[model samples]
Target chain A: MRRSRKKQVIPGFGISMGVTLTLLSLIVLIPMASLVINASSMGFSTFWETVTDKRVLAGYYVSLLCALTAAVVNAVFGVILAWVLVRYDFPFKRFLDGLIELPFALPTAVAGIALTNLYSDKGMLGHFLGQLGIKVAYTRIGIIIAMVFIGIPFVVRTIQPVLEDMDSQYEEAADVLGAGRARIFFRIIFPEIRPALLTGFGLALARALGEYGSVVFIAGNMPFKTEIAPLLIMGKLEQFDYHGANAIALVMLAFAFLILFAINSLQIYYNKFTKQ
Target chain B: MKRKNLITLGIVTTLLAGLLTGCAGKAAEDADGKAAKAIEITNVSYDPTRELYEAYNVEFAKYWKEKTDQEVTVTQSHGGSGKQARSVIEGNEADVVTLALGYDITAIEEAGLIEAGWQSEFGNNSAPYTSTIVFLVRKGNPKQLTDWDDLVAGGVGIITPNPKTSGGARWNYLAAWAYADKAFGHDQDQILEFMKKLYQNVLVLDSGARGATTTFVENGQGDVLLAWENEAYLSMKEYPGEYEIVTPGISILAEPPVAIVDSVVDDRGTREVATAYLEYLYSDVGQRIAGENYYRPSNKTIAEEFKDVFNLELELATIDDELFGGWDKAQAAHFDDGGTFDRIYDGETQE
Candidate 1:
């Protein structure tokens, strides 16, 4: 036993490794494995047919389009919000910082309801927009709004710490070299935070893609129009077509993974380009 | 150091108390010969039955205690009817499922959770009370949404849940189908055309009946809401002048069914109590409670007393009747994937 034992810097390594693997397998891997097993049980042809159905295709389209739009919106506003919080000292600075995480804590159902109530035709903002014939609730715009609500915190939380840790010495050096505000931001500040921004955008996109509760309440759930992928999965589950539900969910997972992978690759390329 | 000692002392005392309670509970469960045995049953139901079952559970517990002298505990889980049924099929351990439609209970049967012919197991086809579909419009009948025709008329924003996910929306769809079939001399194409128009006018299709009501009432999203008679009545009662129920000239009689999950009851050894609990729904007290909740009770005497609340003399079709056939056929032809609903909305090539 002494001859076979390998020397390690940390003791209890075997036990710790065993515990981590067991916990992960039980909590995450096993459930995901079941989803794969269920989807495979439907057979490849059946899976292809179910995922390629017109309604499922519509769900995928609507979910991707809305999530993309919402993520873009969140990225723009999240950067601004973090910049202000880090660089400026307003009266309600601390309160505003705390408020950024409200969406994370408030139940998505309540957010959906409150958002619907605010943007409906009879609501204060909606009533004014109705005069201009611009309907928001029960439309794709409403779905995007709900998604933006749920996704804002992801972007903000991911970028805020990086922004807070950003060195001010570089900006002072650029200023000494007589670089303008716009030039310094583009050549110096932006390159430093590019990786964090990409990570934030990826997280916000993933969150919006899987968002169900808030989107469902405001999506209007019109089958070829405003329906989302998760709602289609729910509809299938309700119909007792477990195989079909699993097939669609697997497709969604694949799509989300592809997008996240693409974002990660882009982030790597960004880092490579900036370093050179 | 003193504060640290106090914290340790408090934790020890709490742990000891928890241990004592656990032992006491185990002893109570094991002490079955002399003392009243405590039993718990879980009743999984649909969204709108929250109020109905809360009142019924209390009454049933009291009745069970008086009858068997054993303490009875009843717990309820409520959500969308189809979702609730899906949970039971996924092993929710529901001793009884009081869903919004017989179709949902049949789903449980299909899952082998309950036996076949569960409808015949209890009185009145296992539906203690029945309700019909109706239109709930803004107060003063704005837009003059009186009957089915008005729902499909141009510029009308109708509010109803998706039939694919909601039992109430199935009733609303069938009610519309029945009206169109009768009005157009039973022409199938005309009925489809009419239904297409009606759905085209649907401003928002919620996932569940209660959600549709909230969208229509609270969010003010639509002009008229197609809803269950009981839900419409409850809305009228709650928001007195904000909305009013419009009993259409034709509608579908909705039978929301209940059944004991045979497998679950057998596993829990609560079959006797579960059976008796459901049978109690057909009893006199249960009928009174059902009527009080705005449901059209199956008890003839009690139903007659609630005529003023449910007074309607319109033609009503049913899901099990000739037009729609039965739940299985209806589920296949209409709400199933690539069925009529998908054809109309998503333009699926029907299989």
Candidate 2:
């Protein structure tokens, strides 16, 4: 195996690795390191105080709860959308596939303003909902709606390729074994797409956690209610409270890192178990 | 193969270096050409001043040309006042800053960009024009929100921006505070209660003044909007009879100040032009343009001329009054983290 790797097509492994590490450090690691350094420069007590302040804690709660809800929603719908696009031959399939990526292409602010306009109390759909005594905008529901809008593309794009690459032989064999439709999907197809779904779910979760633009517009930003962590950081910055902002941001960074790390470990463990 | 790779790397580096130098050379040439024919200055301002400055910039350029025999071009950058100040501090190369409040410019000054006593540099605390807070209600005064006390009355939904993020919203908060101070007879506890009730009625606390306007006027969510007098007028102009501006019995005198960023002007060799640009805002034409844009002119004569246009009868509170002290004290006491505003929401949420 070692000899085969050495004789592979791409040469200059050392040079390529050096370039990759340099670019990664320059583009990603350096800025993140500065954030950590800035946060740490404030004493631990101050950091703790800033992060644990009731308003900031409320912001974190709002952000985490809304992001989790949005990610879960995207996960369920995204899988179905990806499966349909990959498995079926339908009219406007290509157009629908393109449409799924609109959230990714449109500026988040534009998406936010457009969503706010459509969901405000006086808006087209909102008027009916208002008459029904349901308030969507300026509430937690609005925040989740904005997050889901920005997150759907992540889940769908991640799952679509895996679905397309999935082989049909497993399902056909399961069918030949007299398995029911639901059983075939649950036992054969689901297991194959589980890793992709998890990856998509993690990506969407991270994206929604940091979402600011669209969510802020629809959030109404009521403290202890609709204020998200990013807005808290912004509010701190607006007051020229740099140390406080960095502290809150550091806590959020740690949270996002832990979530992604746990998801990746779960995928690895699942992959190992399945292979065994 | 190694030799070929090295050759490719050498070519790429050479191209990148050549491209960078080529761009730098072009920029230098362009600067020299512009220096010979015209002087350019960038005026960094806050959001609501976009239209005001757009008109004023053209007027200033013409004035500069007539007086100095040199063509001048003015560039404008606008955003949330604090964000714009941070941009300048982070080296945005602003020659002049006409921000929404003195505190924002003070933030820039503390960053060592502008000289101290910048407020005293121009007339009226360096504020070319002034505006006050008022209510923008739906047509026919549906809620009849005539005063600040009525805002806290039952069934009246209010829309205002968060003071922490918006310079204009700080004025709005202070204006309400002033009203409460008078209404509650200088009793701190009663004023706090009044403020809490007023905020409780706020359906949407947007991040900026314009956003509050959108929440009130466009979204149709709130019964009344606490907005700048100029902003209220601009909304009426845009919507045409769909909204009405009600001058509250008492409000804050919102003085959006301007100043030349000393370090930047000295560095860029634009002190003279920048100073002239700001000073020109005090000129007669400048005052008229400000009044026409719905901002109450700081020039007493011009303000008198526009008396019919603006409600000059109401009592206006100044930030330097005994109640608030100054911007620094006001900010620390009311809008800072864990301050009165946050405490109000904190207590409400706990209940």
Candidate 3:
């Protein structure tokens, strides 16, 4: 007897694969390949020099650092936002939940300008902070704020569905069995949301890594100081130095892959741990 | 299922409630009725010039208002010049296009804004007003950046916008190329090599002139910020005690030209007023406002009057179609985002 086939969502395999391949080539492969081919014309030393340039290196550091910080901050708060929205009843609760996705919908430039205005030394809240000798608008701190502004939505969106689906019956049972709120949260709620948190973290990191518009204004784009990788690539392009831009882009692309890989492995480990 | 519907409704309501609300103020210009009495003119310019241009606009309105007794709205759309040009090319109704550089206008021409001989119609192959590219260094020259060579020096962090996509950035790139050719003597390889070093030193390449300035002055990232002379001057004027303008030893003269859209005005019977508006930009009052913004006035009398504020910049680096080739050639060979310059960064040119 023949084993049952893995029936799927769509029609026969060839048509689906044809569309998938066409999409992949058009959107990803062709453009990426052209970039690589163009970059290959540059001699290896030039490529090395471009990537190792002090300012480019600084940009790489800033891009990595800000993205990580934003991802971490988002993971924590995102979980709470999702948890509250799912498990609570309050006036205008829906409104507050909807606001979490604002960063996703708003133009990055508008967001950048708004954040810069609100946090600059002479900005609205910045005046108070400035009096306390706190510089927010034009620093690494400002970069993190911009990144978090964009990143929080990624995490919150990822976790909200999971929280919504969770059985509150299990939570109530745990409570009736005399378990404390904190313990019940840690043992029951945390494990269930772990998969989502991991997914959110990965998404947040990826989003932050590629972000340019929102952070550019707030980052102040200083070299060996606040310069970010995307900005470095931009600098390369402006000077009419295509290879330099590509070299920087290649490095960023590699770093992104490595980070995503690590994120995937972590996801795997979390899944295994949850299963156990 | 009813409970599920209720939950869906609740989710939708909450999503709406939770949005971070904001609004953008846009000038949806009423182009027709406003032009009935006074002439309506629009220019595609970069952001920093908005204030100066607006001053000219007010004066222009008054000049024409006195003549025609009409309500002329001299509206201006300001962004990076590249974007402005692209918008014009993509069919934004700009009657008179005054961009940060000629190349952007040329790009629009390629998109069929005007035929080949359009520049000569306004001013003989150049702009009515000319600005230069300069280095906006930190106060007191913290990184010791003085010239094009200094930008390539190890410690220098040069800030500029993307040349391939920004009109002002093309001037900055051309200035560097001009400097390199002058210093190293016009060997194609030497100029290319010098530019490669400079690119390596750039820490932040913002998308536009204002963005680059914000990167420099606000973020304090790059040691040297390549800026429009007028923009640098205006920005310093706006922010007292934040930065200093350091004109490079030799820099490219940026000619921001203006040409009335002959067809647009002729079709609408706005020729007299539109022509008057374009002419007004080169008049004494208009030139004074332009000078106030640090753009060198084309009108001779205006220049002489503002002599004290304006420096006689000598030993200037210049580019033309024959020497540097046009923007398309330069972009294809070196500046195009996907061309030679990108390849250099991609490690195709090293060693």
Candidate 4:
């Protein structure tokens, strides 16, 4: 494998690899390693008890369920929004496109506050929704809304470039071959963008899973209900239970890693199947 | 290629050396300044005391200057009480801490940053000012929520922070528990049931006192807010005719203590200033600032001066009393993981 390597256009591969490794180690790996080290110092039984506590488990359930729902929602609407932005031109197109990135730019806490205000029973939209007997803020629904607001940018940004880069000839050829619009999209267009969509889905899911600041405001933070895992960690830290907090965090990190791994493998399998 | 790598390595080493020397030079300058007529100390405090300290710091600085002829700069860091204490334990360089609860200071004491008996370092258990848990209801009190029993009555929406994360909320919980203890005549089962109902009425358990106030005042979700006395007064002052402070007949005396972080002050050689800074909190101007900021002054005379401003009629339960024993015992029995608070929700979830 080493001998089969081809030369790259970009030189100084060694330097670039060194820089990347150094930055990654400094920024990510070291802190994560410390978390692992701290969690491991707590005996396995205590760590198990901390993570498997009823309230902790409930927090994990709420966080994972809300994040998954939010990711699915983002995947669907993010695609539609990205499709509209990339395929069509309209008034304020640039403005609308710029707005997609607003969630990414705005602090998550600000988004949480703004979304809470917009969805609380007395809020502008919330009042109308209240008339319809729909409640958003301070519930699981509020958590999902905050997650979707923050995760939408990840999905839209990821899929937009993929959609832009795809050639129109494939669609044209499929259309000419007597395929309907739906068939062309599902059979031809979708296969090409599935990898990007999965990536976006993974990113959004991962982001939402760890989101704390935004969701806490809207979560109402009731145990066995709206309490999220990150808030549980915060609670543990406040109690000076660093070991318990690290244990919970370690479990969350492990779950997030597993989900990312599963998505990555699925993407690889899809890429291979499409190539064949 | 080897020569180029060598050149790059040499340049990097030179830059690193230059950066290290720059930092060393700054350290030297700081060391020199430590002997000069200027000093700085950091006061790490809890959330609601932001205004209290903002007013107190300026007065303390003037007093310090007048006394010692030295210009003192006091940096303030505010956040959740326990979080602030944890930061101090993890080395945030806080010369002194004025947090929301005694347990937070106890945690720091356990961490060996402050002395074991730091509570008695100054007057009033090192708590120059005190507050209590009170109810902040809407202007007209439409719920007719007069006391603790009204909270547990059906259909009354309540808002308070999570006790596990908020020191003030712990006091709120203890206050409610104290009321239950008295009302139920110390019947454990009845008290637990009463506490359960009170928690069940809570619509939003925000992570901090300020957030709970926001949930009550800004979001307009809950019918009443379990708030710090100072916080309730501040909200009333901020939005007149929109909210009213309802001092419950029974509440917990929330004595937020202050202590010099021995390790940090000793290391930074600011022990004198840090000690004086906290000491000044009991002074006349300091007491006045505390009163103006709605915190009950620890000084009897100062407290008397603000008797009209504060509610002195309510019976305030002390954490150090037999009810809860102390902050440490109260924390372990009530707010700790799988303690009463957790069990309350656990029972609810099971049902």
Candidate 5:
């Protein structure tokens, strides 16, 4: 008998791969390469001067701090939100689920203005906060809040499906074995969901890194204080310093890539650890 | 099932093709040809000129039609002056740029979009109208704000855009500097200290003039808003009794300049019409419109006609005076990177 051929369930990997490669190159690789090339065209000294300037450095610090803080906050709260939606049923359960995606759907500028209004000294929320002597709008806290608003969906959406698909049998077994709630969560559920949490955190962090419109309104944009990296890049461009803008943008892109790489490695390590 | 999937795929592909071609055609029509029945020119301007330009576009279109009998359309794009200048430098096709400050137009000239010495091409150094920085306080003049001093006084919040980004804010910054410089008899250290205090009291720094206004009026974020004179007037007009325009004893003469983008108009064969459109800004009708809109008209007669509206008698400092020198020197000493602004904010004196 002739050698039997095994038919594939999925069709045309070659065509699909070609399409994926073309789209990625067109959308991502080309633009990133152009940015790097443009940044490098400015001599090394100029690039150094642009990125290492104190104001630019401060901007980078603010952006990284707020993004990371917001991402971590999202990771914790997002998991709780996902868990609640997945484990509980309530009136407007579907509505709350739908509302979780509002940030993704809303224009960032509108969200920013709305948030600024809500947290301003005279705003409904801000009025009570003012009585406590804590200023939220126009401070670093405001930047983090805005980032959180923009980034919440990234974490929730990332981990929601994982939580839903997870079987409750492991938790049941743990409980039957006289395991405490904390031990059950940490020993069983935590290991399984850690990879998804890391992915969500990374996504939220990345989204916050490039955020602009909302932050500007609430940032108060004090140079070397509340200004973020993207605003600095925009400031350079506004001053007609294209090379300088590119230099700063290239630095941000590099830093973000490095961060995302580390997060992915952590995710892979956890995934492997859980598999065994 | 196979036939249904094929039909669905066919319809989707056709829709995508149709959408793509439609966009391509729409873009092509923008710069398709020169003098194709109707000519369109883009005026990239700074914030606060929106209403002025909207009125001017209608007037200019009428004049262009009455003179050349060719249908003409005027489109406007407005933002922070420096930002608008950057867009033009990045190859935005603005036939004319009417910005809040001349330095922005100078930047475009430096980029070689317009010929050198564009200031001499039109009257008043190519500035058709002038404005000043004034205080827009909530009704009853809360914080007892009178001049630049009160802005920096204890427990008062001032709302002004960041000078690094806003042209109007630069005017606002310099006006404060001029006030303190004069008060202290040009003591640089004292002036720097005063600026630091003033900025410390700035509750929020918006990126543009309009954004600053919104922060003050809508968000209720500041006590006194350092604003363009026209903006202050417009706010009082829009919300009667909610705000008051307080003219300071001395204010800087903010000459918002207008210029033709020579390269753009030349390439589009619109040089003649574009030039006329900007020159129309200095005409009697244009001057009257400018005057009525709270801008100090270049024409003395027209400006006097609207004296009740503009409060034109306020002593105003010109940039050409010995104090600020000019835009070039001022831009370097103050607004440039690592300049006075950065030093003041960094709490470092430039020794």
Candidate 6:
């Protein structure tokens, strides 16, 4: 009984898609493809050696572990911040909300430099923390702080809308049914927002993985200590070792892809589980 | 047609992305057609020393104003010394380059930016002013690190950038090598051992010279910092009472160089001005400024004027054009990112 006319939302979808595909292919896809292409310029043995090199390996571990930690922490604190914003009303609430975006607007280099100034032993925070025998700047801990500063907003913004749109009546209904606060939150609320949380985690993790500016100032860049993958890439380029630089970049790109793919799979599975 | 278009789009994007990301400065070829004939010379030099080097540019610009009627605008671009050189080679439009090391200039030459025998074009490899490898110690020498051996004496964290990536760090690395070569008899293995121990003492390797300085001066992580004499002097001057430059009994002589990128200058027709700029650096007027900047003049009296605070006698390293077999081989072998430093860390840290 239904006549199916063309259901295209826009008549120019194909043309736009073509343009988009072309633009993305140039800006994102091709340069990324070159990471692998340039790396392939070297022999397999040389590639293996470069990949397995101690400094490069250290960079890998540092990047992944720090990114993972940052994302996980962002998920926790981001949810907390979102929950606070959504669940409560206080004076300067708009100001508080605006402040959460400081990291997003602040240049990572400036952030790194500022964080270094703040947490250095001679810095104000550093002076106090140093009295207690804790060092932040120029340590892996400094890297974590830098990552956290950059990663927090991704999770906060992602979860904030979900929290705001969340059905408050469900909690009120659960209260009416004699369920406690914790039980209502876990059984009723968390399941509804799991997808958004995963989306935030993926974005945060990816952002942290490729972070160079903030990490560089605080990292202290010691080989096999704090030197990161981006820094290693820079080192290669500085020496005019273009092939070497590209090889290491390819490794980073591969790892970034792997992490993103894994996160996407998890997000998909979570959606399926929740649906069922 | 669709597939072919996709492929073409991909290639165009790749080139565009490279251009965007790399962002080569072509010195904006003199298309101004202004009232006064203007010559734009792109000066690619290393930074943190930018403030001091800009003074040189101002002086040179003044000389041109007095000597000729051409409007010369010298654009000074700076970063890590070695990185500046690489940028020039990759097409940054440097009519003249004054980098922090010969290896970087050598990189420019290997890329055919200049003639094959570019080193012979200037005296002492075009090194304008010399500095010695020294330690940027904490105020009052808390850990009492006197020399390279003291750097490995445990619980003493040293901070320096990667030598492979930084010209100043190369001087720091070569200084350590020179020390090991003298004390333990310069075996490659011994050189490796010393560098390994030195690394073990390092808290972190920063990305650039300024980063390393921050690691020591601001961050307060490292007890001892290997820094350029000029950088160390500037740090002491800037931070005042926060840090001091300690020269070891014998230290590596660090020479920072300048050169004309022959290909670029010849094309731009700025060769006369470029030649005048570099040659001016050797004159008494230039040498005095160089000495004031803590870059030890090749002239001995200029070295002594800054000598009241300079306690460490120079036991200079054996780095020359022949020793490193020019910058090409060095770039291919030791100083390149994945070369010895990367390989060493690769081998050492994998365990």
Question: Can you tell me which runs of candidate 6 are displaced by over 4 Å?
Answer: A1-9, A127-134, B1-30, B187-192, B300-313, B321-351
First chain TM-score in every candidate? 0.94, 0.96, 0.92, 0.96, 0.96, 0.94
Looking at model 2, give its docking quality level.
Answer: acceptable
Residue-level lDDT tens digits of model 4 in A1-276: 243234445666546555555557667999999999999899999999999998889889999999999999999999999999999999999999999999889999888888888899989888899999999998899999999999998899988999999999999998889999999989988887889899999999999999999999999999888999999999999999999999999999998999999999999999898789
How well is each residue in A125-161 modelled by candidate 2, as lDDT tens digits?
7778989999899989999999999999889998898
Count of residue pairs whose backbone atoms collide, per candidate: 0, 0, 37, 0, 0, 7
Ranking of predictions according to DockQ: 4, 6, 2, 5, 1, 3
The RMSD of every model to the true structure, in order and in angstroms, is 6.1, 2.7, 10.0, 2.6, 4.8, 4.3
- Write down the lDDT that model 6 would get: 0.79
The digit string of per-residue lDDT tens for model 2 on B184-259 reads 8999999998998899888988988878888888788888889999999999999998998899999999999999
- Model 1, runs deviating above 4 Å: A1-12, B1-36, B347-351
CAPRI tier for the interface of model 1: acceptable
Q: lDDT, candidate 4, residue A35?
A: 98
The segments of candidate 5 whose C-alpha lies over 4 angstroms from its true place after superposition are A1-11, B1-35, B347-351
Candidate 3, residue A179: the lDDT equals 95
Residue-level lDDT of model 6, residues B1-351, one tens digit each, is: 355446656666677668876654432433545424777788888885686677877888888888997778888898877767777887998998887777778778888888876666777667867777789887899888887888888798888887766778777876776687678865778877777788777777777788888777766667888988888988899989988777786677777777899999888788999998888888777777887787777666766776775653667764653545544565556666455555556654533
Where is model 4 chain A poorest over a 10-residue stretch in terms of lDDT? A1-10
Between candidates 1 and 3, which one is better according to DockQ?
1
Q: What is the lDDT of residue B175 in candidate 4?
A: 96
Badly placed stretches (over 4 Å) of model 2 are: A1-9, B1-25, B347-351
Q: Compose the digit string of candidate 1's lDDT tens values, residues A1-276.
A: 343244455565445555555557668899889999989987899889999998889899999999999999999998888889888997989999999899999999899988888888898888888899988888899999999998998888878888889889999999999999999999988887778888889999999999998988888998788999999998898888999999988888888899999999999898788679
Q: Record all residue pairs in model 6 with backbone atoms less than 3 Å apart, i.e. clashing.
A: A26-B13, A53-B346, A54-B346, A220-B205, A221-B205, A222-B204, A222-B205
